[model samples]
Target: MTDEISHPITMDKRVDLALAGAVVATGLLAIWMAHDFRIGKFPDPLTSRGVPYIAGGALVAGGALLAFRRLSGWRDLPGHLTVSEGTEDEAGHPASSLRAFAIMACAFVWAALLVPAGYLIATPLCLCGMMWAMRVRAPLRLIGFPVGFTLITWVIFAQMLNVLLPLGPLAPLARRLGLMY
Candidate 1:
């Protein structure tokens, strides 16, 4: 006979339902907030807040689908996708929640530093920190990946699309380098 797995704490059905419900509720709030957006003074046809509305819509649809799937028994979750606080290693140590918290904290740190450091500097540093935290051991990537990602973003957004990425403290330097408006 085959066994059905159960993890009451983190992988419970009720927990998944609650999470999906929260996502759906948050998405609805996002949609409601987006309705209050006002057109900016720019001549551009697309309003500043237009993308938020689209994102809110996607969140709503995705959350609804998640709720439906979670509430239904039509599908079975693969082993790796299930969360279990009880899982133990050969040393009998439980899985670390520290990694998840560190990743989330890094995002908050990135956002806090973003305005002061600007896209050119902040993004690369944030990417490097995040990669390191995720245990990406490649030295070349640790150095080169952030630079490549930042340059690609700069080219696509600033150079090709003429979008004004936040220059922050690098405004003058970027202007001198012909990388920013």
Candidate 2:
């Protein structure tokens, strides 16, 4: 016989329950806030409240499923949920919480800069920063992907949807290029 230790319920397993609880709480909060939104004067099929309700409902459903799976000791949970912190990613790099923190910081900075710096300037920088934090080293991909994605989104919002986007200091250049009317 060999010496062995067994942990029927580990701290890592508890983490799933904690995360599920947080998600459920957030969803409930979102639904409550969305319920308070004033109805627009114009009668639109999809109001401002529609998207939030849908998102909140989805969150609640997903969290409930996750919690149920954990409580029932389901063996077929997703790989990411089972993988503990500091585990090696598919690329062989040890996943770092520092990288996650960096990405969050980048997102906060992007939101702070959005109105002043404009979407074109702010979004690419945020995407590049996030990619860098995730260990993307290729110069072409680092530069091209963010720029391309931003431009595509800008066209969709500004031109297709007829939604106004801040041009910031690029207002004159945009007008000259006929990007804005």
**Candidate 1: lDDT of 46?**
56
Instruction: Show model 2 residue runs off by greater than 4 Å.
Output: 1-11, 73-88, 176-178
Write candidate 2's Cα lDDT for 143-163 as tens digits.
999999999999999989989
Q: Number of clashes in every candidate structure?
A: 0, 0
Indicate which candidate wins on lDDT.
Answer: 2
Predictions in order: lDDT: 0.77, 0.85
Off by over 4 Å in 1: 1-10, 39-54, 61-97
Worst 10 residues of 1 by lDDT: 78-87
Clashing pairs in 1: none
Overall local distance difference test of candidate 2: 0.85
